[model samples]
Target chain A: MRITELFNDGQFVVTAEVGPPKGIDCSHVVKEAKEYLSGIHAVNVTDNQSSVMRMGSLPVCVAMKNAGLTPILQLTCRDRNRIALQSELLGAAMLGIDNILCLTGDHTRMGDHPGAKPVFDLDSVSLLHTVSQLEKGVDLAGNELVGEAPKFAKGAVVSPCSDSVDAQLAKMERKVMAGAEYFQTQAVFDSEKFISFMEKAKQFGKPVQLGVIIPKSAGMCKFMNNNVAGVHVPQHMIDALAADKERAKAGITSVEIAAQIIKECRPYCQGLHIMALGWEDKVPELIKLAGL
Target chain B: MLITELKSKEILDSLTQGKVFIINCHGCKEVSFPEKEAEEFEKALGDKVTGILTTDYVCNIDNLPLRLEKHAAAIEAADTVLVLSCGVGVQTVAEHLPGKRVCAACDTYALPGHQGVTPLEHECDQCGQCYLNITGGTCPITACSKSLVNGQCGGAKNGMCEVDPTMECGWERIMRKLKQVDRLDVLKCPIQLRQYNK
Candidate 1:
């Protein structure tokens, strides 16, 4: 079923993310999603996330669809030029993938292949615009498609807790103008900040899914706090994660923290997007604990 | 001023294999240049260096011809004309001296204000459409890593960019500037997407 239909029916959507493997064999990830992520609104398949080369998100999304799951294909403008991006969109549409999340992907320097050239021929906004254009039956070059135009429930990202909240809000407005139907935010740890952001974001009249990143450990929290932009792990939360030195119970602790965040943010947003970051197994427990 | 650093020694050694004439643009006034590094490289080249012509503003197309005319003898004697300047200077020299093999000895990097005549703390990408008016003097195209015109991405922490931890977040700077000038209302205006074609 289309995510748009779920939203239109006023369903409280829940989604999870899974990264494609570096190699061709995708059976492991597919099985993992089927086991842990079934009954969710959708699963997001990352596209060469963090600039690291991986199996294409399109194929993984197709695999998920074949496994009787709905997938939201993450499309980034980091590797492909405008032509390839458009072609990918067309192919995804033909393959029955109806959801796309447009993003201005991470710079190439951040990934495994730093030497690779980055092609940002179109950014998230322009790519979203291109989707609208394609839906209208014409390409960016004004060339007409041979047959039926493909329609999609276009999604976008916003950093609600960015240092510059006004700037983020401004960009969010642009994304809406560029035809973003829904928004999923960067990892949000502070419920107060998320509430404030929702106050402003609600005016756009689009469904927003708050991003929840499960804290694996205190070290991981510190890494994200120091290195990841727009993500802040409160001191108390870090301390809680660090309480268990052996980390034998890290999985349970991580789920508890994620569930707490989801419970706190549930009242403000339309849905929750759990990013387990390789700990997909804990998602089912996290959702149950969050009272979802 | 366009900041330039010497190319890797291995690459330079491979490119300057034969008799080479060096055309070093000392760069504009107040701009920093790796003169000592270039000189050390020349000294290392030793007998392979035919001659050196150190001039200013090789990017000036009109003045380039006269400068090349003066170094015509040195350029004629060498199999390659190695330019120790920015990419523009290398292209200018190559255009003026098409017969000789032209090579760049230094790689150029964008300095904040190098695009303008006088160096400032800001840069203009010359994207043809100026957004300074709306952004309160901040050029998101040049300042932001992703060139996001709408506003900040989610990667900034404590006023620093996630991409380059050392650099200040472009959106933070813009937001501060807007608050200082009482133009924060501009941010509340309707969404405006940057025309990438421009």
Candidate 2:
């Protein structure tokens, strides 16, 4: 089913992300998608996630489509300029990949090629706007398309745990204005903050998929807290993970935390965006644990 | 005004060989200035220091010449004029004092807030293409870890940036605001390609 249909259907949506391999091998991606297909409404194919070069999200998305799985094509502004991005959009449409998530990919400084030149010619907002124009049968420069324009379930991202609520809200407003029909938020660990954010986000009248990440260990939790920007791993969650002596047991605790967040934030959001962080196998367990 | 931290001693050493003249800015009082840092540099340079000139708002290129005129003789004696100010101050001094070797002793970093006032929790990158009007006054350019204009990235876990966990994600806030203002439709308008040259 289309992500939009899931949202409009008024059922709790379930989504997950899968990384394309650094090389051209499609077997792993295909395998992961097969594992996730039954449980998720759609799978997001990341484009060079973390600035690390990976197989293009489009090809992987096409593979997922061929596998009878819905795919959200993750497009980032970090690598492609407007010309390249728009061209790719047309290509994705031609391949019948309609679900697209626009983003400003992670900075090159964070990826393997720190020296690579960044091409943020158009940010996620601009990209979303371009998608809207294409939906209307025109290009960014208002050029008419010879054939039918591709229809899409345009989506964008949000972070409810923002330090500045006003700023975050402002960007969201622009995305919505740019024709984003749905939103998937950054992972949400703080229940209070997530709830408070939901109280406000509901006013937009759009389905927001709360992001959920299961930490594998205390060290992982600490690494996210220290290194990841905009993510605040609660002291209590860290303390819980650190309390476990066995790394295996700690992984269980991570699921418990994720399940707890899902349970708490479920009422406010329309769906859950589970970012397993390569722990794809655990998603089923997490969903069951959260009672989703 | 930009906040700057001193460069490494090794870098400073590589930039200067003979007599050195120091110039520091006391203009950006709202933010921390390297007062003790300048004192340390002065002590470290010892006999090689020709003179030290502390001026207010070295970025004010108009008054810099008059300030430098007073120290003309001392400036002429020094082989290198070292500026312990933000990039703007260093460039201003370099532009005015041609033929003399001008070097900056510090690098500037961004702070939140705008205008010539004390920075708060929000900052602007002045990326020429301002989305503030549609973004409910939040600048995606300055806020997002990647400054993504379209939306949030997959790296964001629990609403935190994969690159930095302590901070809240930028796009998350934008979504909430757009919903609040009921102007989510602005997102539908194609944002013209940004002009970075501005």
Candidate 3:
């Protein structure tokens, strides 16, 4: 099913994101995509992504589409200027790429090189506006483009755990006003926090896709706690798993800590964007666990 | 909270082509904490983050030369390493894995056990003989709650310190405990040498 069509019925969605490798290891990407295609309505291929470059998202997204699966094109404003952004949307339209997820990716300075400069020429909001412009048959500079424009059921990311409800929902409202038809939220570990956040998200009236990334192991929960911000995996889960480390004598695989979260938060989310990273094949097991 | 690199997508993207990176940490407590902090630091490090794995553990000093040979698969998986072990271990890891970016993830202040969390700013300055006994086993320079030299400062309010309401005045609590235990006379004894020789 096309993701746009899937959202129309809006029962429960299973979308996943695939990170393309920089090296010519399409073998892993292809294998992972095939694994994802069975249970997911659509798979998004991230662009040069967090500004740490990769083989561009468009080619792989088109490839996924070729493999008889819906693909969401994640276009970021980190590298490209407005000219590039508008042209790509039009190009995506030409290529039958209908689902566009717009982002103002990570700044260049945060990557490997500290001395590198940043290009924030267009933030995510402005990028959302640009996508709307393409839908409206115009360019970013207020000039109308020749011929028809591309139409996409655009979605923006909302990190429900990052800012205050007002701040996140305000952006959600703005993105919706700017033609964002859907929202894919950051990983939702605490369902109560998201339920409260959704009370505010309801004003925008767009579908919300929850980002569900299962932790790899016990150390990962602590790694996420100590490292990954915005998403808070409770201290109890980490401490519990750390305690269970001694129970390798039992049948408990370390990855089971993540499986617990899916069981916990399944009721609160509309759908989950399972990002199993390297463990893409585990998608089926997770979906089965969720009873999706 | 300690940031080695800030966020920038442009730099992050360019560095993805960089070779995989790894750091070995041999499961020591100090290395474990710093390794976590270092990995978090690496995540904030926009790009060029290939892979990070803290080593299994180290029991003896001599375990390096031969066991490091067994780490050929892990060593070959990266182009750089920020060793989270002490200087000796860093040198040991680097001595074997030549021509790789090996830096210290842990600070040089190698101390034992629970008290050393490595303050970004030094908390104490030992000016020779410690006066811990005079202040009830709490050094004025390090543990007076406010480092008040002569006595509890005005911030010391009614048994508790004002700077942190939960904390009793370092001097006040020390004095009360000594009096309660009939050790008030011991308050006059000067502290024994507490200079951190290392």
Candidate 4:
């Protein structure tokens, strides 16, 4: 079923994110998507995530769709301007890739090619409005479409960890007004904070999927705590994993933490967005452990 | 108001290999002015400084030209014109003294409020879309690192910013203030996406 339909049916939707490979090969992604097909509602294909150069998200979503899995094409404004973004959206829709997640991607300075020029001509909010305009069979310049307009299940990313909760709420409302049907949040490690965010999001009357990233190792947990923005790794969770000397045990402990968050956040959020973070093969195990 | 810190002597020495004229700004002292640093610049530069000119308000575009013209002879004699003021003051000097090797000696920080005076504890990015009325005068644009206008990012561990541990989460302050003012219904209004151009 389409992701939107799953939301409408009140089904607990589960989506997982996968970054495309650095090259054109899709065999690994196909394998991952195949594993995700049974347990998750949709697979969100990430754009050149973290400003790192990767295979484009569009073809990967197409590959996933061909593999009998619903694919949500994640688009960012870091690399494209309004014209290119509009054209790509139309192309993706024409190719039957319906679900699109709009994000204001990380600045290029954070990526592999630090010298690369950033094209932030439109942010995620602007992209959503442009997509809504396209859905009306018109372009941003008020130009009419030659044929049928593309129907899109628009989605956006939110971070409930923001210091400014009201500003975050205000931006969320704007995205909904601009045509975002659902929101997939940043990785959430705290349940109480997620519950409070949901109380405010519930007023928006839209589906929000709590983002969960499985920590692979104690070092990884510490790294995320130090580097990643809008990610909070509690001391106890890190300590629990740090106590495990072996890598295998550490991985299991991380999965257990994800399971705990899933169990706790399930009541407040309509969905769970598991970001495998290169541990795609382990997502099913995490899902099973969470009893989703 | 902009806060400026004088460039390191190593950088200044590298930039100005020859004689240079210094122009200091005594503008907007209510916020901050580089008084001690300018005094040290004179002492450090010694004979390298051909001349020094101080303007009451270098940011005053109208009166600045006449003030700078008064030092035209000394400025023309020097090989380079080094400005020890905020970016605005530097630009004003550069605008008046065209065709000169003009460079800044200070790094200007982001301005706080409308007059650019008083570096505020709380800032507004002036993203062209203001939600202050609903947010109880708090601006999410500057308070939140991600500039989220909807809800918190859920990364805060204990009422602090996930990105910066020492900082309070912008949303937490907003929520508390909203409750205090009893204006929680503002969250119900479906704010339209920012028209950035507007």
Candidate 5:
């Protein structure tokens, strides 16, 4: 079933992300998702996330689907031009995939191959618009498709913890106008700020899934504070993680913090999107601890 | 104004291997030319440098031909002509001196100001569709790293941009400006999808 159906049915949707391996063999990630993420509504397969080269999200998503897991295909405008992007959308539909999260991917300079040419022919908003157009059986050039048009439960991302709330809201409104049925925010750490952002975001009338990133270590929190855009790991959480010097107990501490954040944000959002960046083993515990 | 920085010494060295004529433009109003750096580079080049001709406003198409004519001897003697200026200056030199192998000795980046005129704290990308009327004087296309038209991308920290921490977030600046003018409601008017064709 499409994620939108879950949202419409008033079920508190739960999703997680799985980064495809850089090599062709994705059995490890696929097996990991099937084993650990069975309770979640769907899994998002990132497309060359952080601009690093990896196995395409499409094939990995197919792998996930073959494994009896629902996969949300994450599409970015950084690698492909309009033609390639449209073609990929059609291909995903042909393969029975229905969910897409459109993003204006991280700049190429931030990736492994800085010399690679970035093809951001369409930003996130335009790409969402393109998705809506394709659903109507027309291509970007106004040409009709030869076969049945592809349909998708379109989604987009927003950053609620940004310094500028109004600017983020304005963009969220645009995303809604461009046909984003749902939104998964950037990793949010501050509950009070998120509550306030949700208050304003409620006006958009779209289901917003709060993004929760599992903080693996205190050093990881600090790194995210400095490097990750729109992600601010509060000092208290850092101190909490830092207090657990014993590496054996770090996973327990991480899950506890993630659960606490989920509980705090549960009242405001319609769903939860956990990004356990390589720490997928702890997700089952996180879900249980959060009482999901 | 166009902010320019000198290319790395290694790149300059590779490009300036042959006898080269240098044409440096000091015409921009407020843009700082890397004169000291260029001087050091020329000194390092020593015998490889055929000649140096410093001119003003090399981007001026009408005056460029006369300026190149005056330096014809030095330019003819050199195998390569190195133009130290913004892209416009280098292109002008290349167009005028098509026979010579012309190369740019600097990389140019945009500043928050009009090109070839008085430098201000704001810039216009000339994206044709002006958003200033709604943005309250701050240009999101020029100010934001991703050039997001609707608003902030949620990557800002303490008003600094996610792409470049040194720079202020464009949407933050726009919001502050809008608030100061009591026009924050303008951001809620409608969805704005940038027309790339425009």
Candidate 6:
């Protein structure tokens, strides 16, 4: 099923992101995608996330589909402008891709291939507007499409923990205004703050997908605290993980803590996007334990 | 994966400066199934796994000093290193850094990254065998193109694969790519899969 169907067809559905390979290798990406086998509702195939040079996202999603998995193709504005973006959207629709997550991609300078050029003609908002037109049976150029336009359940992302939450919310407002059906968040660490933010977002009239990350270790938590953007890992959680000398000793407890957080926040958000990063295997157990 | 999360500070302690170390895969790095399957292994050994940093160029002999300078502290302190580079790099790191537990983070599929939706599938194993001279350069393990091991089953369709739309179906992609690159007649004989066991 398409990711859009799950959003409307169920009370809450679980999804996760999978980064594409740097070459002609599906085994690793497919293997990483297996984390969704037991319970994850869908998977989001990242399109060259972090501006890193990797395989394209559309074919990767098709690979997942061939494996009988529902994949949400992540489309970034950093790579294509109105023409390419619209054409790709048409191709994806024809190819049976179900869900889409649009964003302004990372700056080209940030990737491993620093010398590569970037195409950021239209930002995420403009892309959404263009996609909305595709759904309306009209090409982006104001010309009528001969064939029927596809029914894509559009989704966008917001870093709720942005330094300026107000500004982030303002951008989110524009996306919604552009007809974004749902919204996912960047990795969220502090649940209390998310709850507070949700109190304000409830009026938006769309389902919110909360992003959950499984820190590989306590130091990983510290790393995210120190470096990752729009994410805030509570100190108490860090202290709890750090208290254990061995990570294995604290494994169950940490996942339990994560599951518990999901439970607490379950009522506030529509679903969770578990980003285990390199730890995709445990997502099934985590979701199962949470009864999500 | 920016260090975005850790910076979300509350009232008490303010987050200061932070950094993330990334390995440049140069042109040799590729991610495969082993890396995907290895996640379960990491989960089984939870909290023990740090992020696997893959580099195509930096983890080599030429750049060893720079790599050591950047991660010597982390390497010395940790029990295992999750390498996201190719299998050769992982094995090389293992050999260079004895007494340290190092494992492969990516599956080491192939050297190409610019094509297909599922472009991360296992294509080339780098066994030092060139079968493209016979059956075209498409990999059966990675593309699973037509599932026709020795030759085309006539099931492939117009450039795009039949089984998986994401992949080029090694054979089909190879036929087209070779034709494009002016090497269409490379298939002088039938491909024998057994000689390239690895």
Top candidate when judged by DockQ against the true structure: 1
**Which prediction has more favorable lDDT, 1 or 5?**
5
* Candidate 1's DockQ: 0.32
- Which DockQ-derived CAPRI band holds candidate 3? incorrect
What's the distance in Å from true for residue B181, model 3?
A: 56
User: Candidate 1, residues A1-292: lDDT per residue as tens digits?
Assistant: 5787888889888999999999989999999999999968899999999999999999999999999999999999889888999999999999999999999899888899988987776788878988998999999788999899999999999988877777788778878888999989999998899999999999999999999998988899999987887888899888988888665255877788888888888888889898989999888888899999
How well does candidate 3 match the true structure in TM-score terms? 0.56
Q: Residue A272, candidate 3: how far off, in angstroms?
A: 1.3
State residue A10's C-alpha deviation in candidate 5, in Å.
Answer: 0.8
Give the root-mean-square deviation of each candidate in angstroms: 14.9, 14.6, 23.7, 14.8, 15.0, 23.4
Q: List candidate 4 segments past 4 Å from native.
A: A247-250, B1-198
Q: After TM-score superposition, what is the CA distance of residue B114 in candidate 3 from its true location, in Å?
A: 54
Where does model 1 exceed 4 Å of error?
A246-250, B1-117, B184-198
Q: What is candidate 6's local distance difference test score?
A: 0.61
Compute the lDDT of residue B45 as modeled in candidate 5.
85
The candidates' DockQ values read 0.32, 0.17, 0.01, 0.16, 0.31, 0.01
Q: Is candidate 2 or candidate 4 better by TM-score?
A: 2
Q: What is the DockQ score, from 0 to 1, of model 6?
A: 0.01
Residue pairs with backbone overlap in model 5: A167-B152
Interface root-mean-square deviation of model 5 in angstroms is: 2.3
Report the alpha-carbon TM-score of model 2 versus the true structure.
0.67
Residue-level lDDT for B155 in candidate 6: 24
Instruction: Point out the worst 10-residue segment of candidate 5 chain A by lDDT.
Output: A244-253
What lDDT score is found at residue B95 in candidate 5?
Answer: 50
What are the runs in model 3 whose C-alpha is more than 4 Å off?
A113-115, A246-260, B1-198
| Tens digit per residue, CA lDDT, model 6, B59-163 | 356666566567776566564454444434444454455544343333332344432121132333443332332333344433543233333322233333433
Residue pairs with backbone atoms closer than 3 Å in model 1 (clashes): A229-B155
- In order of listing, the candidates' clash counts read 1, 44, 21, 32, 1, 29
- Model 2 complex DockQ against the native: 0.17
